[model samples]
Target chain A: GAGVSQSPSNKVTEKGKDVELRCDPISGHTALYWYRQSLGQGLEFLIYFQGNSAPDKSGLPSDRFSAERTGGSVSTLTIQRTQQEDSAVYLCASSPNPVYEQYFGPGTRLTVT
Target chain B: AQRVTQPEKLLSVFKGAPVELKCNYSYSGSPELFWYVQYSRQRLQLLLRHISRESIKGFTADLNKGETSFHLKKPFAQEEDSAMYYCALKGFGNEKLTFGTGTRLTIIP
Candidate 1:
């Protein structure tokens, strides 16, 4: 079975720019999540989607961060007006349901200069 | 606020030695605890969960509610056991996990 896959494994952008990271979850997973891993901060949850709608976006650091899932499959995380502090590995994970074990993607390493 | 803490940032142990990666979490309600591991160049994956009570790769974690801890332990550490370990907690029915700071375990050959 194919696992979760993320595109653009690495991205480098200047400050104030915007970037979009894509995530393709497992074939039948109904839940998807995004997280950021930065030095010392560990892995910080960003947003989660149950089906096509996100029930929890509280973890999103600011309005500059947003996500959308279409057709109940592919998801995209967009960071607008990126800052140097945003340099981190953006990870995507998918689960069979709301309570199943999660399978993660390789993650997109985003560098904001 | 839910929080997970891995007290040691790094731990080193010789092969065949017992190993323990300490993890403590703070949450208001009963939570499901899990241990996740990431080998070099690999994506993070689940190692074990308190609910399953199953050991993976000779490692186990026990969730202690009274102490709010879920420490991962292995009786005999192997060189291949070296990796970054993260302790996570999930609210009942809420799949989102709060991960610990992580511990880098080095098993010397």
Candidate 2:
């Protein structure tokens, strides 16, 4: 079975520019999550979506960060006016439920130059 | 706020030697604890979860509520075990995983 997938394995953007990262969750997965991994720091939770319930946006670092899940299958994380601090590997994961084993995709690395 | 902690940023052990990776967490409720691993050039994957109480590839962790720790251990370290290990926790209602800074393990043959 196909696991989760993400687009644009690598991206280099200028500061203050905007970037969009895409994620395709495993089929029939009811839960999707986004995280960021930076050097020295661990994976930071960004956002989460489950079924049709309102997405949990608590982890978004700032107002510039946003994400949306369409048709409950794919999700896109957008960063507007990105900063140097936003440079990191963005990871997406999916699971059958909130407590189930999460399958992770090969993250998209974003570098703010 | 719930949080996970992995004290060691890096660890190295000889092959066939006993191995232990420390992990501690802080959460008010009974949290779901998990250990995730990522090998070189491979995507992150679930290694084990406390609730399952099952060992994966000879690795096991016992959740100690009194100590607020869920440290992963293996009787004999294998070269393939060398990778990054992360400790994570999910609170009952939060449902979002809180991860700790990962520990990179290297097995010396």
Say which candidate scores most in TM-score: 2
lDDT tens per residue, model 2, B1-109: 9999999999999999999999999999999999999999999999999989998999999999999999999999999999999999999988788999999999999
Summed backbone clashes in each candidate are 0, 0
Model 1 has an lDDT value of 0.93
Q: In model 2, where do residues sit more than 4 Å from their true spots?
A: none
| RMSD to truth, every model | 0.9, 0.6
Q: Per-prediction fnat values?
A: 0.82, 0.91
Q: Number of the top candidate by DockQ? A: 2
Error of 1 at B108 (Å): 1.0
Report the error of model 2 at residue B5, Å.
0.8
